[model samples]
Target: MTQLETAMAILMKTFDTYAAADGNKGSLSKGEAKTMLEKELPGLLKAAKNQAEVDKLLGGLDFNGDSEVDFSEFVVLVAALTCACHGRCKK
Candidate 1:
């Protein structure tokens, strides 16, 4: 697979791995999302100014107000982070 394809597969795998933690394979609960962020995106959390900011960011993930983050919502977070990081790198 090409690099982008490989990345996409990894993203799906990562989401599935975390989303399955609570036996709900369909989406990630709030706890699952927090754990995923803390474990997989440690740097992002560390960069946050405070715990409240991290909480705010996590709260924002449930875009549909469904109290869970599905694959599409998760992808939006990943894409936004990727764009931010890429922009930072080019500076």
Candidate 2:
């Protein structure tokens, strides 16, 4: 697979791996989202100045107000972060 294809597959797999923890294979509950962020994006969490900032970030990701993050929402979060880090990661 191409690099983008592999990245997409990894995104799906990572989301599924976390979303399946509570038997909800389609979306992530708040706890699951927190766990996923804590484990998968520890640096991002650490960059937040406080717990409220991290909570706010996670809350903002739930665009539909459904209290759970679906795959599309998860993709938005990843895309936003990628954009935020785009130039910063360059050597």
Candidate 3:
């Protein structure tokens, strides 16, 4: 599988772990992701140019435009960023 696929798998496993730990079940929603980022990775998201910029970036992964990105879609977005960052790191 590709790097993204692998990363996505890892992300799914992570969500599963979170669910298991919390006694909850099912995939994460877009709002949940935004909350998690705000609470857990505040520094990363604080760099966003503005709410619209952040929303646009989020929109790339919000395939359905429901204003909610599923865990799998979130994984894809994260993995894509990770890959890009890794590339820059290697340069």
Candidate 4:
């Protein structure tokens, strides 16, 4: 696979693990997913201005209106972020 594809695959794996463990990305308690993001995503996203913004961004993707972003939603959001960063791997 190409570099971008490989990056995306690794991202998907992270989402899968988070989903299987937490059910919904948003279901992750405050600082939980954020900590993971810090570790895994690194430069992928700008530092969220506040927890509210983080919640809002994640909430926007929670299609079911549940307070959690599911694996699919997380993937979609990460994909957007990847595109925003011009396909560069953040790690």
Candidate 5:
């Protein structure tokens, strides 16, 4: 697979791994989302100015107000972080 293909696969796998943690094979519960962020994106969490900011970030990810993050929502979070880091690296 190409690099982008591999990255996409990894993203799917990562989301599935976390989302399946609590009997939900297709979406992440709040605790699962928090654990995923704390474990997989610790740098992002650490960069947050405060716990409320982290909470806000998580809250915002639930764009549909479903209280659970599905694959699409998870992708948005990854894409946003990737874009943010890309800009930082280009500076």
Candidate 6:
């Protein structure tokens, strides 16, 4: 697989690994989501600087207001972070 394909696969695997913890294979419970972030994106949480920024970032992902994050929501978070990082580097 190409780099992008590998990255996507990793994302799927990571999301699955976290989501499976709560026995709800389709979406992550809040605890699952928190564990996923703490384990998979430690840097992101640190970079956030404060609780509000972290809250704002995570809050943005719940577009459907279901309180659980599905695969689409997980992917959007990664993509948004990537875009934010890329834009910063380009500046």
Candidate 6 per-residue lDDT over residues 19-75, each given as its tens digit:
999789999887788788888889988887898886776667787999888999998
Order of candidates by TM-score, top first? 2, 1, 5, 6, 4, 3
Q: Candidate 6: misplaced stretches above 4 Å?
A: 88-91
Q: Tell me the RMSD of model 4 versus the true structure.
A: 5.4
lDDT of 1 by residue, 20-73 (tens): 999999899999999999999999999999999999998999999999999999
Worst lDDT run of 10 residues, candidate 2, spans: 82-91
TM-score of every candidate relative to the true structure: 0.93, 0.93, 0.57, 0.58, 0.92, 0.86
For candidate 4, the per-residue lDDT at 28 reads 47
TM-score of 4: 0.58
The superposed Cα distance between candidate 5 and the true structure at residue 10, in angstroms, equals 0.3
lDDT of 5 by residue, 1-91 (tens): 9999999999999999999999999999989999999999998888889999988988989999999999999998888888888885342
User: Compared to the true structure, candidate 5 yields what TM-score?
Assistant: 0.92
Computed on alpha carbons, the lDDT of every model, listed in order, comes to 0.94, 0.94, 0.64, 0.64, 0.92, 0.85
Tens-digit per-residue lDDT, 36-85, candidate 3 = 56665576688887888766765677777765666667667666777776
lDDT of 4 by residue, 15-61 (tens): 66655554453344334456557677665346676767766765676
Which 10 successive residues of model 5 have the least lDDT summed? 82-91
Candidate 4, pairs of clashing residues: 26-69
Let me know the TM-score candidate 3 reaches against the reference structure.
Answer: 0.57
Winner of 2 and 4 under TM-score = 2
